[model samples]
Target: MSMWIRIDDGVATLALTPPADRAVFRTALIEARGAMLSWDVASGQRFPDAEIHSPLEASAWLAEIYGEEIAAAVRAAAATSLPVPGSAELVDAAHRLAWLMWASDWWPAGVYTPALNGPILAAETAVAAHAVEHLLDDEDAVERTLHQAVDAPSALAAVPLRLRADAAALLDVLTGLADDHGIALSAATVSTSSADWALAAGARGQIREGIEIGHGLAPVRWADVPAQTVAADSDARWSLRHIDGVPHLHVSVAAVPVAAVPSTEAPGTEAPGAEAELWARFGPESLDIDIPLQGDSVGFTGNMQVAASIALLPLEERTLWIRDPLLAAVPGPAESEDDRDAVRAQASIRLDDPDASLAERAAAE
Candidate 1:
């Protein structure tokens, strides 16, 4: 199956024959945006896609946006097939287009920091595209393109002084994309290097307490727990926290496999799905638990309300146990509030200053 873009009447529509995978869809969108950028750069015309809409004055709007020559090229390309320019310049422009789209959704704008100028960014992308168009085969093309684009008087120079750093960061990303085009095409692989990738991959989740306890509780070794049932690096942990002056017991299992609690079916009987079995035993409504297992590595996070009773027991008698469906307990030391707070603070600071060094942003909860 192949994906194509069509401009019928006055509206542009992306049509995929049958249906394509997410990677194909993503590549199609990027190529479409690159085609728009390439046309604008070649014709020296500025027309954002958002401004054009179907109306009674369709001809005027279309002329304002696509002009005549470029409009004809778009119609020709749509009738045939979208041009897939695998050159570094076009790839770099496509990456910039992707980032600009993402920034429209998630760019952080504070009192001091302003929102990204889309037109300006688009213009800079065009300039950078031209600067690197012929340098695709150069050994140091990425760096050279970065320098040429930054030094030239274009949209990059027009960006506000306060937002220049942010703009420069975008330039860095574009250069990196120019250097390695493969990373730009892969949508499934989450790269920690760029916030755009992480955001696109859904890696950024809700903020949670990160507790690291070193002392005060001993590790509880379990001989009955089978090795095959647990995932590699599996660990059962517990934390005691005073939330709003009430003690709460937070329990978690890291890297636990779906088979942690095997089915109790007869030797040859068919069993339910792993998810169905897991929900039957530890469903959120039944146990007030959180099972955020979307991949092979199963995990659990739940709080016990009877934490005060457990905390009142002697240090050695404070052992936790579970049976029937699954036989398990806290296999590691109890976490401390201070440690959790420290981790949470670091996370908060990191959210604010993503560019900050890990060591420098370590002091937070």
Candidate 2:
């Protein structure tokens, strides 16, 4: 397998693989970039460089994984023709391919050395990228990782990829903050999960820590962004950041909860019943939650202030109830009901500390 990596020991020199061989991945990036430059000029809307590169970079790595023929259209774009598909379609297909490599065991996590503490999460992402890249030469693994990336929380094993131990520790700090603010979340049993978001040089890009985070896990684009707190374990000091308001929490290098499945009577929902621990982020520091009980009333805690007069969701309607409030917060620039609805489709209702604006801390407190 063609290997790609960078080693830096905080020195002037950095070790690395031969630059992309000026090969299929690079070729694809060039094509995607050229096409996008023209597309942007024609439209008079300046698409960011990162956006263009995000999908393209992923495609090149994918071509390395699956087969050149798999990326033929994308590669063709460089010298002669751009991929026949649209940019969005191209991005989706590439990630599907890269991840499929891992699903097939072509890129098992074992081959890479494990990190005990420093940058464990970054190492994991790097390992995943390496494994998938190594598998590109093989056809079978490419197909599998693509399928798994598309499926999610499906019959597919969750992979425990959420890094629950680490996220749990972050959550403890968050919940404590929530308690201090009296911010309460609706009582809905929510669980968290994650997917590796990667993009290659495409028509767009995003610079994370100076390196592109790729389009795969770009913050604005992730759908079904399920996030939740870590389950309690006596030995673990970690707490889960169940609130979805923190912008960067679940983006790159972070695990997210996707859907809140109700644990109580009414199944297939995100409502607070007898076991609701609704953790939500109002602003960066504020968290809102709704705890459930048999009676109509709900409870609140943390560094938040919930109006006692606030209404709690009925056990059955809790998930949808949280959904509505969040939907209302979508900004005024929404182009259509569909665009607005799309936002709601991805989020649910969790109580806010009423002080949940982005700058609630600097402004009021």
Candidate 3:
């Protein structure tokens, strides 16, 4: 495959002709971008721009980063004017493998997106590493390099039993790739067998079951509320409940679908009295709570639980005013018993008493 490089406005771009080579080149470029270059801020330039211009120069640079085997392949391809001797599937799989590696570092764990369990992450990384190795015939080179960085398993193990179906599906993909490439995946088979036996023997215990908060809460319009403090499609709810012989008031506001509301203020300008109004609204005894944009929605829940006296207010006084009553994401035709249970479960958690019964927490705020 032919490699082309272009530079404009201090940005560098590399392009490879033909789709298959382009995929492989993109993957390698992702690998190189992080480690291969250093910036000279004083000179406003990057060092060693020379090795990136032609295929021969690129191969020499690749040798320093990815070792001689990959570099030799690139050199051979450039000389013969032919694409690399790897299938499109291998390139695609390798790209995905690289992404999973990056996800291990940069995934934003939150309420909707739960933190990656350590063993599960390790097992997934191990599977992806093995698949890349088989696809590239690299003899565990990728796996070994990854192990040096993180505690990536040499062989997949400790996969939770609940995730066996998912693991099997991943292995099935690897198996198909192996079949297409005419390679035997003995390591993967052995690893799978061991994991299955361990699961059957209860060697690795089950993943901890936690109550999924906000399970049935629907997105409501911001304009529905009198204050309009939250963004559109925000999940907002308030309730008063008795918990463990004590009353509690629970209020929650979650920016659903999107984590944060975009700022409406113009550049280099602050809205007049906005900061003062925000402070007043979020101050003590106020019904509104400041839900930080960066944090999970659960951060805004149960803010008024300490001011339980609000629960003693008359139903008319405590009523949540809605400007447009029907402006909500409608649930199914009828709420099922399970839906009711989920709502009760969520309400109990928000009321700051996990053991409270549904009947005790019936009233809405």
Candidate 4:
């Protein structure tokens, strides 16, 4: 129940009531790190939960109470092997702590860039691994087991159901990050909450060639799939590239997509197809819009201003398609202008169809 940091002599020691719950205990460790880093050592002052002690006493107490993992960190600090911070270092570390806390909330909601998400999740996994290793007391053995679990996630299936579930969720999130950014992934998982919400947010999974999302697995390509596409306007630029043999259109937004004008497809008239099923899942508030991006008027041979315009709808109303160039293009935050255009251009679904080959069109052009 109590968590605090004590600095005896020149050695800093972290103490906390280790929660039996793995998730809670892991968070407690993170909090402890932040607390220890912020403790003021000057003026013989200590924080509400902070303590100061001699090097020998602190190590012995930590080793007895928290086990070897934390004790190792403490001993390392005592030996000056660990990077001990001065006042300036404490300030910088505090800033990092604040950013991570804020990021922890936003990343789960798909509010970060592909470039940033992978590193954040990777660091989190490492921290969790350290905590697990300490609690298990096996050091190298336990750490190896965790890495093994990454390759064989089901290896944790034999663990307690709750522990297994947590492990799975962790692996799923990490895998999602790796898959999205075209990074090599071995054994890892992502949170089930994010996966479930992704599906509910109009995303789909291509299981056979993809990573786990929840009870099911989705293709890594889903990370590139945007809820909808938008073309900025007349000045919008476009580019093309191929990933894993799939060519994608990259667009610069000259004019952004507009909101849907309400669907003409009335309820109970006819059965909705796949796209309709996608919208129906969001209830009745969703609207459907299908607008085309015609060629630019400025120069006859200028790049086309292609926009799908579905992203302008509510997130639930919007449907994500695997074939959309946007789905294969890495996503930026909802507010990123230039990056958003690039993402929209990558989402170009027009040339995605095999029936309408790009080479044939190029020949005609």
Candidate 5:
């Protein structure tokens, strides 16, 4: 059979000699958006395989063909619900996506954020309501339905996801830009290969807040529940969550230069449950260093898209330490859960003794 793998860029390049198994490559590029996979046709596998991941690393659907069927399968898998507001927009966007499948020569892969260049547009947001109602799984069938049914699809398959003329407000407070509109904040479903991995890399989700972004120092108050005491370190910074599940506040404090971090937690078998999970007093301490995202860090504080670029993803891919050496290496390539454990260990050490040198803690580990 012919081989294929899509680069981050949308072009579907083919390969003759294939070494990377669909599962491994699928796992590696788990979060790639605009991914759909067709096996020249879909055949029955003994057990159903499902891999969930972020838009960036989501698995490419295995399809019989790459066009609308792949798209349809995705819509089927999406099965739950799109983070849309009105019914009309949902219909429109669905159809829009369906047509994209046919025109793209059936990429068989699914539609990713980048492939969905623009936001779901207004006119088409409601396009999918009825037609997709019955055809449920054939992306191509669905697209043909849309084209045969609605407005003419632009010739280019790469148009951004049509932005709903009605831009939903991610938050009520996000009214400064555009008109007086604020769509309800919807959580983007963040997926990971490992459920445990997700919980561990959760800080990443805290960054996405489940939606597109708004701007400026969005005030994030991290007060421990029941206790009702917010962490005292409050300043303009890039925060990545809202009032949700387990509350966590990630703050980038200035890096403090120090030597010899005092050994606070003696590495010994502690009586299980004897030790408290948290020593709030040892939250974290470091010299103030403005955490930079994008570029300007000073006046930047406000709502941001949950998937807003980490700016560190590329580097993190190589080594988790590059972004925050204190951080355990991220779990992508050339790393393991051990990396995360290592980070936790280093952080624990650092937090125990705030005055310790970052260098010392890193080396000691």
Candidate 6:
């Protein structure tokens, strides 16, 4: 019957009276739930400073929507003893609790405002510090952002707290793998939907980016490495490079085609299917690439180049296939005009230009 928001002592408190109509109340609860989750994600970004106070009203706010059970859980999580630094479980718990507060409509304005209580701010700072430490150490996080310099298309989204927890869990798993392989990661990011992540290691002068990829929805690990571009077109070109004398490939793809589904048909058997039947499948948002021709194809193999070759297939029906695939790769700077030309020639394959060919450009040189 009533909804109110109040900010006091850097904490925002929300109170709501349930509506008489069940349907109306349900809608309001749903909106509040979404707001809370969003707040958890945003609040995790920066530690509670002078501007943010604890969501002191989280328990009451949650009770109105989800009842006392969830509210109790939030309070219990908050009161739970803080964990020692570098403890993954502790990090997970802290972030989870913070997010629960946000999702519960407790953290007003998506921030953990400072409170007069020292313990509350201390606990929040611990979680925020843990997350920020890991992110700062991850050099690939910086590299991922830097890819924009080469015109690699990328996207930035508001990462939710659940995803943040999942990412922390994954980081724990990978930290062990890195230790075993002597692979020291400066920075990394985990994507649950893609079940993959990009990591960086080596000293400051010799940092290298490596990708950990999952197989068909399975989570990937350090052992499952050697990430390479599997299915690619001429436009998605790659070249060898040596950074500070350490050899690695520099790949640049304007657009990546969706991979083809691995057919279950028997070998040498032509599955009954039209060209259109095959082309409609979309690739995963994140791919575990083992490039076909470049580097070592350790993790993946076979030509499932669905996106690039789909246009060449004979089809009875005309359908529009439009995609805004993010630009990808870590192509080092070009060394020469010829190299620049070659890179340009290969990168132009996605263009509608029929005359685009790396071979022609090579001959002209």
Q: Give the number of the best model, judged by TM-score.
A: 3
lDDT of 2: 0.23
Q: Please provide, for model 1 over 1-365, each residue's C-alpha lDDT reduced to its tens digit, 9 standing for 90 to 100.
A: 22244565655443333222321111212223222222112111122222112322233223333334434445444443342222322334444443333332222222112223333333344334444343222334344334433322233323335445655555555546544533221111111122111100121222244332211322212222322122212344556665565655555432222111122211111111123211111212333333332222233334544334444555654444322134333233333444323333433443366552211111110
* Whole-model Cα lDDT of every candidate shown, in order: 0.31, 0.23, 0.32, 0.28, 0.23, 0.25
* 1 or 2, greater by lDDT: 1
Compute the lDDT of residue 39 as modeled in candidate 3.
19
Q: Against the hidden true structure, what lDDT does model 3 obtain?
A: 0.32
TM-score of 3: 0.28
Top-down TM-score ranking: 3, 1, 2, 4, 5, 6
Give the winner by lDDT. Answer: 3
Q: What are the TM-scores, per candidate, against the unseen true structure?
A: 0.24, 0.21, 0.28, 0.20, 0.18, 0.17
Deviation from truth (RMSD, Å), model 1: 21.5
Which runs of model 5 end up more than 4 angstroms from their true locations?
1-117, 120-125, 137-292, 295-330, 334-365
Relative to the true structure, candidate 6 reaches a TM of 0.17
Score candidate 4 by TM-score against the native: 0.20
| After superposition, candidate 6 runs with Cα above 4 Å error | 1-96, 99-302, 305-365
Task: Give every collision pair in model 3.
Answer: none
- Worst 10-residue lDDT window for candidate 5 reads 108-117
Candidate 4 per-residue lDDT, tens place, 19-44, comes to 12221101211233222222211111
Consecutive 10-residue window with the lowest summed lDDT within model 1: 191-200
Q: Write the per-residue lDDT of candidate 3 for residues 3-105, one digit (tens) a residue.
A: 3334444333333432222111112112332222221111211111112334443442354433344445444443222223233334444444444443343
